[model samples]
Target: MFLAWQEIKKNKLRFTLITGILMLVSYLVFFLSGLATGLASLNREAVDKWQASAIILTDESDKSLYQSSMSIEQLNDIKAKKTAVIGQLNAIASNDDDKQNISLFGINKEEFLMPNVTQGRAFEKANEVIADESLKDKGFKLGDTLSLSSSDQQLTIVGFTDHARFNAAPVLYANLATFHQVKFGEAADQKKDQINGIVVRDDSISKLTQNDELDSIEIESFIQSLPGYTEQKLTLNFMIYFLFGISSIIVAIFLYVLTVQKISMFGVMKAQGISSTYLSWSVVAQTFILAFIGTTLGFAFTLVSGAFLPAAVPVSFDLTLMMFYGLILMVVATAGAVFSVLTIVRIDPLKAIGG
Candidate 1:
């Protein structure tokens, strides 16, 4: 460690440049990781809030909530200790010239799916709605009237709920009757009560028999089935993996070049009886020290960047996930130093010193 420190001190400019490169790469990785997490949350935040074990959907819906529909009589056929009937629709809410796409969820106020209002009170009357707090960014507010596109029905925003978004859009929660009216308009009374799916507890979900008409899907699977959810995560993860590989290559090339440049110095030391094992270990120690400094600075930069990012930008930092990735980076960096260590071990004292 002492010898490694001495070498770095002697070539401060070179080592500093290498450290800077590593820091930048690490920073990019962490930033992208946070963005990935934030985007994933937007895709499934509302469903996660339900905390249900599984959801019961029509077998023919292919695990997609949008395609599933069940009559009230079918809902009664299934039994569970905890259950909630839910309706879902993609709708545009407009206020004057301002418009935003939203996921309208039809839920009974008394059911477990009803999100607790964070601001104002839950809806108490027909046509009253509770919306995700994110809608505020689009100029929506409590008491604002939102007109449904293509329909005469209008809704009043009575409250705001935190962390209730779906498919990267704000969610609007309305009573079941109100949703039926908004969905069917004049035909609401003519059609029977129908819901998109049912939320059920994990243990209680087993009570459901393998009926030909209904299928039970785990909550995680349901989230994965959301449109673009899996594809988005796969794309971001591929980028992150590529960065990790690049980080390893950068460290290896820098260390190997530095070791090559110091071959004569190492040969002189070996001639004076310094062991090859000690010199090889010193190269590894330097790699670890440089990687530690770079990754630490990079993580700090990520935190600062996250702080300044606009709320409109979806980026969420998870300390545990970041730490895990950082550890993996450090390991890969140490592995990258293997070539430098081998070069140090193979130095011929007589040939190098004579040259």
Candidate 2:
């Protein structure tokens, strides 16, 4: 350990250069990780907040919650410990010709989870809407009337909530009846009681044995069926994995070349009776120190960048992921050191000493 430290101190420029490269690589990986996680959250924040153990959608819909429709009778047939009806629609909201695409969700006022009215009461009457804080930022205020296209009903914002977004759009909560009316227009009267699906709080229901043609699936299973969630995750994971592999290879090659250059020194030490085990430990210690310094700097950079970034840019840090990735970086760095140290054991002291 002492020898390793002395060597690193003697070659400050070389060591610093390697550390800088490592830091840059780690920074990219960490930053991309946060971006991926943040985007995923933005895409599915509303559904995640439901905290429901399962969601039931029409089997015939093939795992599409947005398209699946469950009649009121089917919802009643679902005997779960706890359940709530959910409806989803996408439409444009216009005020004075300023329009924004919005994701509209319908919930039974009695069973809605999350967004528990930070300002005003939940939707209690038809045509009343509770929206996210973004609405205020967009020049909307409580009691302000907004019109939905293709509908005669003029919706009124009744409340504002935080942390409520869907598909990257601010969520607007309304009563199932109103949502049905807005979505189906006149047809809503004949199917006023229907819902898109049932959100289950527990998994006590027996494997579905329904004779109806509709499909049923757990919430997670349903999310996996979304158009691009799985593919996006896979793509991000591949990039992260590739970065790790590159880091490992770069470290291994650098350390191996450095070790080869120090072969004579190692030979002299071994000839003086220094055990290969102690030398290997020294190499590993140096690797640990380097990785720790590099990754720490990288983490700091990520936090600083995140601080200065605008709110519109999505970047989030999950402590568990940070720790896990840190550990992975350490392991790969240490493995590289080990790969280099193996060459030390193969050194022949006699030839090194010119015997």
Candidate 3:
């Protein structure tokens, strides 16, 4: 370890250049990882928050939540331990003549995973709505009237919530009856209580007794079945894997060539009775030092970048992924050091000493 430290200190310029390269590579990997996670969160945040174990949709709708529709009877038949109706629709929400495309979620006021009334009361009437704090930036406030397109029935912003977004749009929550009326117009009868699908708490329903008209799937499975979800995940994973491979190869090649250039010095040390084990430790210690510095810098860069990103950007930093990447970087770096040790073992002490 002492010898390795001395050598690295003596060749500061060369080691610095190599460390810089590794730092940049690691930074690129972490930055791309953040972007991938952010994009995925934006695409699936609302669905994940539901925390439902299963979902029931129409079998005739080709397995798409957007296209599936269920009647009151179809929803009730699938009820198990706990069930709630969810009505989804895409429409425009306008305040003060400024309009934006938004996803409308019709939910029962009594059931939801993370529903907290941050401000004002829950929807008490048919044309009331609650929205996220982000909507404030678009000119909406409590008691403000927002109109849904082509509908004479205007919605009042009764409350605000947090962390509620759907498919990159701010979610507007409304009572099931109002949701149906806004989406289906006068065709939706408030007295008859109809909804799009039923969210179930479990999936242990007997297959033989199940209704053939409705498709029941686990919530995780249902999210995976969404269009572009699997493909986007695959693309992000491919990039992350490629980055890991590139990091390993760069470290290995740099250390291997550095070891080769110092073969004569290692041979002379061996002639002086230094053990092969000691030389191997020297190489490993140097590799670990380089990896530690590079990875730390990369992590710091990610935090700084995240700070500057807009709030609407959905980057989420999970501790699990951070630890996983750190372990991976260390393992690959140690493997690179092993490659360098192999070259040291091949050095002939007698020739090195000119004996």
Candidate 4:
């Protein structure tokens, strides 16, 4: 510990430069991680709310909610502890000329999947709607009326819920009857009680899917199958993995070269009866200190940057995930320093000291 601190104190400039580089790398990795997490949440936010075990849809739809159609007959045949009918539609929610793309979810308010209202009362009448808090960014307000482009009926925002979104659009919760009316118009009777999917909580979900034309899939599988979700997550994760590799290489090469520079010093120390284990400890100590300082600086910068980041940028900052990332970085850094320790261990005292 003393040797490591002495070396760092003596050569402040080199260590400081290395720390700065590490800090920059950590910042990039953390920010990218946040973006990936945020985008994923946006993709599956509403479904995540269900906390259900399985979802039922027709296999013919190929896991697409928009294409899947389940009639009243199919819903009646299923048994569950609790179930919710969900009708999904893509439409423009317009307040006069102001328009925003939205995924309107028509839900049975009485069902277990119904979102809890945070700002106002739940929807109790036809044409009444509840929006995710995200819609507030688009100029929507409580009591604001938004017209679905396809329907003559106007939707009045009666409530707002937290963290409800699907496929990157703010969700609008409406009654199943109103949704049928908005989607199918006066001929809505033709599509009455039709639902895209059913979220069910049951222990016997596997048995429930034994029937042909109905399949029950885990919630995670359903989320991953959504368009662009898996692809985006893969691309972002690739970058994070690449950064981890780069961090390992940078720490290894830099420490290895620094150890090489101190070869003669190590030789003299060995000649003076110092142990290889102590010398190796010094090397690891330096690497750990560098990692600790760099990660702390990077974390601080990320926190400050949050205030400056725009709302449009989707970023999820999970403390547990970030801590895990930091821990991995430190471990990689320590592992990189092992090469330096080995170099010191192999040094011959007599040759190094030129006795």
Q: Specify the highest-lDDT model's number.
A: 1
Clashing residue pairs in candidate 4 are none
**Model 2: lDDT of residue 59:** 68
lDDT of 1 at 218: 86
- Give per-model TM-scores: 0.97, 0.91, 0.90, 0.94
Q: 143-203, model 3: which lDDT tens digit per residue?
A: 9888877566688889988767766678888888888788768777753466667777764
Candidate 4 to truth, TM? 0.94
How does residue 49 of candidate 4 score in lDDT?
A: 92
For model 3, the stretches where C-alpha displacement exceeds 4 angstroms are 149-153, 190-193, 203-209, 353-355
Q: Identify the superior model by TM-score, candidate 2 or candidate 4.
A: 4
Mark the 10 consecutive residues where model 4 has the least summed lDDT.
Answer: 202-211
Residue-wise C-alpha lDDT for candidate 4, range 1-355, written one tens digit per residue: 8889889999999999888888998888888888899999999999899898888888898888888888856877677777777888998889964788899888888888789999988999999998999888878899998988777989999999999989999999999999999988988988887889988888767765555888888888999999999999999989988988898789999999998888899999988899999999999999999988998898889878976988888998877888788888778877889789889989999988777
lDDT of 2 at 157: 87
Candidate 1 TM-score, C-alpha based = 0.97
**Candidate 3 accuracy as lDDT:** 0.77
Backbone clash pairs for candidate 2 read: 58-215, 59-214, 59-215, 60-215
Model 1 scores a C-alpha lDDT of: 0.90
lDDT per residue for candidate 1 within 68-114, as digits (tens), equals: 98886676767777888899888899986579999899998898999
